[model samples]
Target chain A: MGLYFVAKRFGVFLVIVWLAATLNFFLPRLSGDDPVANKLMEQASLGGYAQAGIAEMVKVYNQHFGLDKPLLTQYLNYVGNVAHGDLNYSIANYPRTVVDMIAEALPWTVGLLGMTTLVSFALGTFLGALLAWPGAPRWLQWFMPPLWALHAIPFFLLGLVLMWLLAFQFQILPIFGGHSPGAKVGLTVGFVLDVLRHAVLPSLSIVLVSVGGWALAMRGMMVTTMGEDYVTFAEAKGLRSLTIFMRYCMRNAILPQTTALALALGQILSGAVLVEVIFGYPGIGALLFQAIQENDFFVIQGVVFTVIVGLGFATFLLDILYPWLDPRITYRRS
Target chain B: MSETILRVERLRVAYDHPRGVVRAVDDVSFSLRPHERFGLAGESGSGKSTMALAILRMIKRPGRIEGGEVWLGDTALSGLDTDRMRALRLAGIAMVPQGSMNSLNPVVRIRDQIGDALADHGVGLKGRALAERVRDLLAQVGLPPDVARKYPHELSGGMKQRACIAIAICLRPKVIIADEPTSALDVVVQKQVMQTLGRVQQDLGAAIILVGHDMGLMAQFVDRLGIMYAGRLVEVAPIRDIITAPRHPYTRMLIESLPSLEQRGGLRGIPGLAPLLRELPPGCAFHPRCPAATERCRSEKPAVRAMGEDATVACHLA
Candidate 1:
């Protein structure tokens, strides 16, 4: 059953990727206005070429990019190239491959945004669990109103608020960028610490906006799960509060959050686009912003497809892990 | 005289809802003897289930045991703190819950469900000992050993009830409250499950409180019977005495409602709906629906008085 589930998910995933890439190839074409002509017109005078020379340049550009081929061949070649890790070259950042751009941006996003997403999930779920616990302290109840208010703040507005308080007003934390321009980039503890210090404000902005959402979701799930008969049975069993909370209540409640966790992890690729743009964080989110402004199709396609693949992969993993966590969920069910 | 293993003195449980306060279980008092099979027979909404939860303090907020003293042996259950009550729960008194189909955790294995009660209540046994205990409990409940490897959803209704029974008896508490334990099962399965429960109680030598609306099943399974109406206990007597000759009007109506195999007629349902506890008439709570109600019955309540050494009834007529 497990193997069947894996194979089924893998097959569906391949089909989705093929559809996305095909759409990527056709969508640009369907927009009309020859891209090569546009690229050449922007860089050089089109009137300088003879009529045959212009056709020759256009054909050569299309042929070099494999765009002159039949749609099927182009799709196959796109799939093959993607399989080989080639995401084409960025038009805006001339000569830099999209793969290269992604590689450069990934570490920054993972370090700051990925870590913050995980921190939000972990810290939020813990606090939420505590708040939902029947025996939880009354003092902890005071945190809910503030948490809900925090959660209601939009991502970019929060970025603005954090910058205003910590950067503009107090002038304590750095307002923008991943690191000081003068700081060395290396394995040394000093350099690493400097990078972390600069990441604090950007990461904090993302965390503050999202943490409350996870906490609220988790608390809601806990409330409903607490109503299940298993919870009452657990209480009736005379189990310790910790034991009951962790084994019985949490085992049931955490299933939904695990799914949320997977989707959130996939979202880490472009983490908080506006916040990254505002802070100049040099993450994929900022790259995508720059790509859109320049109409850098190659970069946009690469980033968007990567996110799609990431989301699909995360969902596949969740599908596999679900039955393990919830024994009631079996692969055989229709 | 038989030793009382569990006792309730003036127990009252009330729920505060938006509509009004409902006195779900009002001033109920009863006692259970060792090796006794006691049945609390009541119609739907008669507070039998609420009283069961009241016995264990399992009622959540919006509901509270307003006035109560429940003693599992000597310990006053209502007075114990949360942690102390938890420790005393499965060890001193356990429960075989109603809706057996849902009582066992669906995701949990039968082994874990049964073994957890043992381990959590300081049984401190694991591996072979735990497995052996699980197998023994399963066997006692007439379940196959392989059931331990399966989940609740994998089991049948009867099997789930059996598993719940095994869980209840795992700690061998002084009293096991089987609240409508067989209500959700078919007649044949209910009989089998009841037999399994009866055997488990006998083997463990523990008392049981069987609460349900099925008067016929109570007459067959329990030694003593208590009848509840509008949150109050109207009759408490030996099962044979109550079944053969009941004193309280509600008790008589309940016995009459049971379809007798020998009698060729449709079932006799009591006339009139039970009064909402929130808006019960002044005086006797049962007076609104009582045929024997008089001017005195409408103006005054009746105290439960001993009819003899073996019976007690609450009625001005009695």
Candidate 2:
């Protein structure tokens, strides 16, 4: 039954990825503007070429971008290129392939956003479990109002306030880029610390806004699972309080968080867009925003495709992990 | 008489509601002897299950043992701290919780959970020894050895109940509380589960307090039974006497409600609902439904009195 579920979900995953890639191929072209003409107009604005030179430039640009081919042939070639793991060039950036731009920005997003999300999930779940523990400290209840308020605020708005207060007013954190402006980039401890220093503000904004959600979700799950008869049974069996809380209640409580973890991980891979933009951090969200503004259709498509694939992969992994985490869940062949 | 394995004297458990205090087990008392099966037979909300939970100190918030002295062999259960209570729980008195299907943790395997019960109480079994004990417990409860590897959901309702019985008797506690253990199961499964529970209890020489509303099931399993009504013990007698010659009006009513082949005139349910705990009727608490209730019965509370050898009743008429 497990193997069948794996195979079935894999088939569905492939189909979703194919649909996303196909949409990437045609949706940009359907905007009713020719890429070659757009490029010509761009150059004309710069006043570099005369009419005859501009015409030649357009012809060369069309061929260079593989836009000179018939639409059907281009479509087939697009599919064939994607099939072989080839991502063609960015029309707006000229000379840089869409894949290379994504590849360059991917690490920054994954590192900062990935680290913050993991930290928040871990910390929030632990705190939430403690808060919901029967007869937990009364003072801990004071944390609820602020956490609820934080969770309700949008990430971008929170990021703006954090930047203004922590970076501008207090001057406790770096305000721009992923590293010190003049620092040499390498494996050196100074460079790594500078990078981490720059990251603190951006990651903190995301963590502050998102941890509340994890805590609230986990606290709710813990409260419900704690009431289950098994928990009482555990207590009745002379198991210690910590044992009942951790093994009986938290074990079941963590199941829902694992599912949320997969989706949250997928989301962070797309980058903490507003946080990145606010801190002037070099990440995929900033790159994607620039591509959208310039009508770099291929770059936009590439970024979106990456997001879609990440989400699908995360979901598939969760589908497999869920049953293993919860014995009450089982797939039926029927 | 054999040694009293467990004793409860004037146990008063109540829930503090916003409106008023709901006396769930209001000044109720009972005792169980070694290897004796004592059943508390009552309708829903009669405080039978609450009384059972009170003995183990398992009642959640909103409910508490207001005034009670519970004794398990020699230990004073009511005064023990949480740590001592934890030590006394499975090692002194185990519980087969209601709806055995969900009594075991769903994420854990059957063997591991049984091992947890063993390990928590300082049973100290580990490795091959632990596995052997788990296998032995399973076999004692009539479950196959391979069931140790499977999850609770993999087993049938009867199987889960049987597994529950095994866990309850694993430490051989002097007294075991099987609260509605077979209620969720079907007839055939209930019979099988109860048989396994009965056989194991007998073999281990454990006293059991079987709490349920089903008088027929209680009669079949227990030799002595207590009939409860509105948080009060109405009658206590041998199961045969309670069935053949009940003293309390409520006991006769309960027997009348049961569908019997011998008394087959279409089951007659008693009139009126069980009292809401927060607003129990004055005096007898059953005067409104009792055929023989008088002004005296309505004005004064009746105390439990000896009727005959091994028979007790709390009704003034008796």
lDDT for every model? 0.84, 0.86
RMSD vs true structure, all candidates: 2.7, 1.9
**Model 2 CAPRI quality:** medium
Tens-place lDDT digits, model 1, residues B1-318: 457888899999999989889899988888898999999988789999898888988888899989979988888887789879988888878888775537776667888877777777788787888889999888999999999989988988888888888888887787898888887789999999999999989999999999998877888999999999889998999988988899998888877887878997888988898888888888777888888889988998888898887678889998
Show model 2 residue runs off by greater than 4 Å: A1-4, A48-52
For TM-score, the strongest prediction is 2
lDDT of 1 at B254: 78
Local lDDT at B14 for model 1: 90
Q: Please, what are the lDDT tens digits per residue for candidate 1 over residues A243-299?
A: 778877777788899999999997777564776889888888888888877777788
lDDT, model 1: 0.84
Chain A vs native chain A, TM-score per candidate: 0.89, 0.93
User: How accurate locally is residue B274 in candidate 1, as Cα lDDT from 0 to 100?
Assistant: 87
